[model samples]
Target: MSDALRDRCEELRAVVLELTTTTIEAMGKPSKLADVVTVIGKLRAIGDKGAAGIDNPDYLAWDRVYDASLQKMEDAARRGDAQEAWRAFADQETGVNLIARACTGYPGW
Candidate 1:
């Protein structure tokens, strides 16, 4: 991979890890709209950054999945439903893993 693409991918991978850590930490505490909003912000940032790798299908798919998950989390947070927010967050873990894994296969182009 070119340095730019590799850099973008690595940055995305790091952010994904950060998001996971933030969520896992939140899981140990009382779910707050603030906490969920924090995750939503991170997810938004991730989506923005992931756009750098948009030519890659994995990145594109990650964007799609993450957007959907972000929306779900936002809806729950907006409703002040901790249980639903947590459920949406739990459902998002798979896409989080996909995002991390996606960066590992960036091709040289």
Candidate 2:
């Protein structure tokens, strides 16, 4: 993998986890809702780009999991569903962990 790819992986991980943090912090504060929306948008943009060069099936599997989590999160945010947000975050956390672990099988990983 290129340094760029490695960096992208790290960036994706940070942004995904940031969503969880943003949602948690936004729970009671109406002001933080904007931040949550921003993070979700950022995450969606990153995810929609897909993993360009990575050819691993494991990575793709993780991506699918992450995408589903993102969809769930997006819907939950729209409805202001905190419970579903929590569940989605759990799924995302697992997906992120799987993604990181999957990276270990690659060249520089």
Badly placed stretches (over 4 Å) of model 1 are 2-4, 31-33, 49-53, 77-94, 105-109
The global C-alpha lDDT for each of the candidates, from Candidate 1 onward, is 0.62, 0.65
Model 2: per-residue Cα lDDT at residue 33 = 56
* lDDT (10s digit) by residue, model 2, range 15-107: 756776777776765456567667877877776777677666656676666667667766776777766665666663544455656556444
lDDT (Cα, 0-100) at 76 in candidate 1: 71
RMSD of 1: 4.6
**Leading candidate by lDDT:** 2
Give lDDT tens digits, candidate 1, residues 1-109.
4465567666565555555565555556545466667767866775765565356565566666777877777787677666676676666343555555556766421
Model 2 regions more than 4 Å off:
1-5, 28-31, 56-58, 92-97, 100-109
